[model samples]
Target: MKRSKKVFITLMLMICTLSTFLVGCKKNDSKATTKKDFNYYTAEKLKEAIEKKEDIIILDIQVKEEYDKHHIKGAMPTYAFPVKTDEEKKKIDDVLGKLEGKKPIIIVCPRGGGGAENTYKHLLEKNIEKDRLFILEKGQTGWPYEDLLEK
Candidate 1:
């Protein structure tokens, strides 16, 4: 082949390789994966789980006063309500460190609102699997099981 034809072929090959590489390196969204939200467990279900002695971790993120006033029994308190600041986020580290095993983590926020979602997202960022996390339905505010609460 002529030199020009050889160079042209080489260029085409390089372009093809580059195209393949770029396509391969593309950030592909998860396929067939459903968009996830907080897997909420009702207070009733939580009570049942407790009664059945099922393995579960209740992570309470209420402030110290609120938590002391009334909170779920056996809940691991981070005392980091709102969980907005880096320090408050760090507060959860103690409980997070102790969080092991395959038990589902039920997050007990004050109102089961943004705080819970934030904590959930933070946990995901900290390498906790989404499926293993749950937000207490309506949080502590809507929990009707007085017996389950530790005042």
Candidate 2:
């Protein structure tokens, strides 16, 4: 009976030690694996950012026609559709060239969702650092128009 009790105690100790080691390892692994992604800002915050004259590029991904009607005061238009050819890529590069690579990019779409999301993903795939990307929470739908400009 004493031998059986010793064996059981040894097993329990081993399990406890293994579990604690795994938990500690998991915490470190998570810290290392954590990744930065595109950030979301509310309309008010975007206004504040603009007012502060923060170094940012507001990339409007709405269709050209809609963008022409009205858009955030200093937004540059860039269609959200994927670039298919070298010419299309050059056009995108031209727009991107207007700002320095380190400038934060704020993406806005007509009503958010697909356009903004897809554009965000495309930019990521293009190797634009995630820390430099942001999205307007609700796009033009949430914008107050106080800082809007019409072309």
lDDT of each: 0.87, 0.74
Tell me which residue pairs clash in candidate 2. Answer: none
lDDT of 1 at 117: 84
Number of the top candidate by TM-score? Answer: 1
Q: Give the per-residue lDDT digits (tens) of candidate 1, residues 1-151.
A: 6999999999999999999887766635433222256688889999999999999999999999999999989999899889899998998876777777688999999998888988988898889998999999799999998988899
Model 1 / residue 1 / CA error / Å: 83
- Candidate 2: tens digits of C-alpha lDDT, residues 1-151: 9999999999999999999999899888843432234578778888888889998899887767787777899888876433444654454567755745798888888876656766676677677888888888888767875545555
Candidate 1's displacement at residue 151, Å, is 1.0
Give candidate 1's error at residue 88 in angstroms: 0.7
